[model samples]
Structures are given as structure tokens and as C-alpha cells.
Target: MRKSYLKLFGLACMLTIVSCSLDDDRVNFQYTPLQITGASLPDTFELGRVYTVDVNILRPDDCTLLDQFDVRRSFTDTTQIRTISAVGIVLDKDECAALNDSLQDAFQFEVLYTKPYIFRFYTSDDSEGEPEFLEIEVPVKE
Candidate 1:
């Protein structure tokens, strides 16, 4: 009877250790990106032209937060003479309004300029993995 009790105690202790180890291996937590908004424009933005676009971001739960996030643009026609970059610089409402006003009625812009304009969000833990990406096509006018 004593031997049987010892065996049962040993089994219980083993089970407790296994349960603790299982909990440590769990990575159920996650991160997300909330709202993402931006635009695109013609090669040369002309004053008084209307550039239209549909701006939307990935759902928050779908994306992971990171130390840095960047947007990359690549034009389909290399000969089209255009430049694209992420709108990283901070601009006040007046400046944004001015830009919109300038592009309100001068040139024709479309969202199909490139194949992949990637939005990459770099994880703070660089050692762990690469940043997540969200692709978008924004419209612009000149």
C-alpha cells in the first residue's frame, strides 16, 4: 500500500510539472494596427486638380504593432517619370488642405500606378522576426 501511494504521488508531481511547462510555451497574445490612411498623386501635382482615392487600413487584429512602420511605392512604368514615398513627414491641417486644394482640379490621377505599394510594420523585437506588411493602392492627381 505504501509503494502504491508513493507511485501515485510521483505521478501527480510529474503532471504538475508538465502543466507548468505547457503554460510557459503558450504565445496566445497578439498585437494589431488600428487606422491607416494615405493617398497617391500624379508625377507632377498641378494646382486645382482632383485626385480621388479610397483610403482604408487593415483591421487592427489582423496586423501586429512594431517599432517602426514604413510605406514603399514602386511604379509599374519606369518611363512614366514619377516619384513615390511614404508620407512620413508630419503635416498640419493647413498644409494638408493646401495640398488638397492644389490637386483639386488640374490633372488626372489613378490608383493603378504600381504593382505593390507595401506598408511594412517592423516589430520591436527584431531578433524574433521581420515586420508585417499591408498592401494598398492609393489614388493621386496633378
Candidate 2:
């Protein structure tokens, strides 16, 4: 009887383990580009100094959360240009609310090179389906 009870307990444990699932209802997060309305940058940058750049962005819905600033630097031999864009982590759930709200966000930028830096903030696509940007140049003060 004791052996039979132990066998039954082992079968129950195996059944419980088999009934558990690793799949969840939460959908996979998608990274999407957000629209940058405007940005507040300093007129000049000082070497080895950190500056806080305020950026205004627009989101499609409340389900989208700001992931980080997609700062892509140009690897060209002549130009010191960086493209500043905002990427959002989207949670595609059923209860997500749709709204178009402008949000203000800031990021820290440190000046390393002595040359002038050109920032291209992504706004949106134009009428011809071309990417538009708000370009600003900040020279390094020596």
C-alpha cells in the first residue's frame, strides 16, 4: 500500500508539471520610432562637459513607452554628425488606450570631440515620403 501511494504521488507531480505552460498572454515588445517635435540644445558645447538636452516627442498611444534615445553617430571621416531619434517600446495589448500627446523628455550628452557637432532630430516623413529632420549645429568652445 505504501508503494502504491508513492507511485500515485509521483504521477500527480508529473501531471502538475505537464499541465504548467511557459507561454504567457503578454505580447512581445516592439521597438518603434517616435516623432520628435522639438529639442532644446545649447548654443555651444564645452569639451569634457556634460549637458542635458531636452527633447519633445509625440507618441501614438499610451501603450508606447519611451525606450531610449537612438543616437546614431556618423562614422564618416570628415563630419561629426549624430542623428538623434526616439524609439519606443510598444506593448500591443487589448486594453491599450489611443491618444496623441506631446511629452517632454531629456537626455544627457557629453562633449568629447573638439569639432563642431551636428545633430539631426527626426521629425517625420515629408510629402514625398522622405525623412525630415530638425538640424542644429553646436560648436565646441575652446
Candidate 3:
């Protein structure tokens, strides 16, 4: 019984040494997130006329990418909201990892009715983190 106990202890020590030597060499990094600093849109709009809004974003670094762009319109009552139509930006993997750290992209959409509409810009990063938004009011005129 004593010999068996010694063998078990010796095996356990060898396993521990082997495990300690198998450390990973890869480094993990936490990057700064992308932020929507501000937005620019027309103070008023005419019904059926298309308008463009320029959205300014502050990126962390060149490696940061714009994962998604969701432009939505809502009412002041907070009971109705609808997504505005936009030609989705198609970018390759290389293009997404751009060298620039800031961007001013334009989103085009039209309004059908005149009221107090709230325009919201929802953006995400390549890291798939929670999105940041820029909300503004664009009143439609008759």
C-alpha cells in the first residue's frame, strides 16, 4: 500500500509540472470603443424630399470598424418607431480596418408625413459591443 501511494504522488507531481509549462503565448488586448460624437441634419424637411444627415464618429484606432448602421425614426409620443431606408454600406474586410480614426458618413432618407419626428442613429463596432446612438429631431414641413 505504501508503494502504491508513492507512485500516485510521483504521477501527480509530474502532471503538475507539465501543465505549468503549457502556458499560452498569445496576448489579449482591450481596445477603446467607437463613439458617435455628433450628428448634422437639416433643421426642417419637405415632405417627399430626400434628405441626408451626416453622422460623425470618433473611432478608437485604425483597426476599429463600423459593424452596423441603423437609422430609425420615431415620434415624440414614444409609441411609434420605424426604421428609415438606406443603401447599406458594403465594405470588405480590408476596408473596414481603415487607417483613419474618424469618419463622417451620410445617411439618406425621406419623410412622408409632417410631424415631430425623432431621428436616431444607432451604430456598432467590429467588436460586436453594445451600440451607441445619436438622437435628433427633424420636423417635416408642408
Candidate 4:
């Protein structure tokens, strides 16, 4: 009787441990990775040409659709004639880091005016780190 009771107790303990270890795989995890593939404008633009700037966001390997905004852009100097639409996106830290490897070689637009033009893309939270800036020389159209 004593041995039987001990065996039952041990079995119950094992079962409890196993049950706790099993997580519901059916439940989707909330953590999703976001990334940016490329963001740029045309290489050349005519004077006083109004063009829309395109910012591209890439979907993570595990997800589809880049429908989030943690990325924003602003002109460093206000004296420039260029303007960006208010419809900018934001990206999370994880999402930003995922693109860090690829962003170095990403396409960049050249500022073609006499005034110094700087485009800055900042993370959602400034406290996270300093914002990234792209300085381009706006060439004066002859």
C-alpha cells in the first residue's frame, strides 16, 4: 500500500510539471518584427517640382503587411523649399534593428538646391536614441 501511494504521488507530480510546461501553440504571439526595405525620392527633380516622397516598410519574415507607424521624417532646415507629407510611419526598436544591416546601403536622395538640406528620420521615442539624419546638397538649377 505504501509503495502504491508513493508511485501515485510521483505520477501526479510528473503530470503537473508536464502540463505546466506545455504552452498553447495555437495562441499567436503578440511580438511581431517590423522592418524598412527602402525609403527615397527620385534622383532628379525639376525646380519647383512637387513630388511625393515614398517611404517603404518591409514586412517581417513571420508577418505580412507593413501597417504600422514608428518612423517619421522631418527636414533639418526649414529654409529649404522641399516638404514632406504628414503621412509618415513609425517603427519599433526591434523593427528598426532588423533593418540596421540593410539601411546602410539604402537609397538616398540628393538635395539639389543652394540651401543646405537635411532629412531626418526619427524613432517613435526620442529617448530611445538620437535621430538619424541624411544631409544632401541641393544643387541650384542653372
Best lDDT goes to which candidate?
2
- lDDT tens readout by residue for model 4, 1-142: 9999999999999999888855554433343333334446555455554545555444433323333343334444544543221222243223332233322223334445545443343322235654333333343342
Give per-residue CA lDDT, model 3, range 1-142, as digits (tens): 9999999999999999888854576433333334566777788878888877676765644545455455454555532344332223233234345354666777677777766567655545346655545567777778
What TM-score does candidate 1 reach? Answer: 0.21
After superposition, candidate 2 runs with Cα above 4 Å error: 1-13, 75-78, 127-129
Model 2 residue 113 distance off true place after TM-score fit, in angstroms: 0.7
TM-score of 3: 0.50
Q: Give the range of the ten consecutive residues with the poorest summed lDDT in model 3.
A: 84-93
* Lowest lDDT block of 10, candidate 2: 73-82
TM-score of each: 0.21, 0.80, 0.50, 0.32
Whole-model lDDT, model 3 = 0.59
lDDT of 1 by residue, 71-90 (tens): 33334543222222222223
How much is 108 displaced in model 1, in angstroms?
37
Between prediction 1 and prediction 3, which has the larger lDDT?
A: 3
lDDT of 2 by residue, 1-142 (tens): 9999999999999999999888967577889889999999999999999999999999878899888999988835654898999999998777878788898999999999888899999998899989899999988887
Local distance difference test, candidate 4: 0.42
Q: How does candidate 2 fare on TM-score? A: 0.80
- Model 1, residue 76: what's the lDDT? 51
User: Model 1, 94: alpha-carbon shift in Å?
Assistant: 41
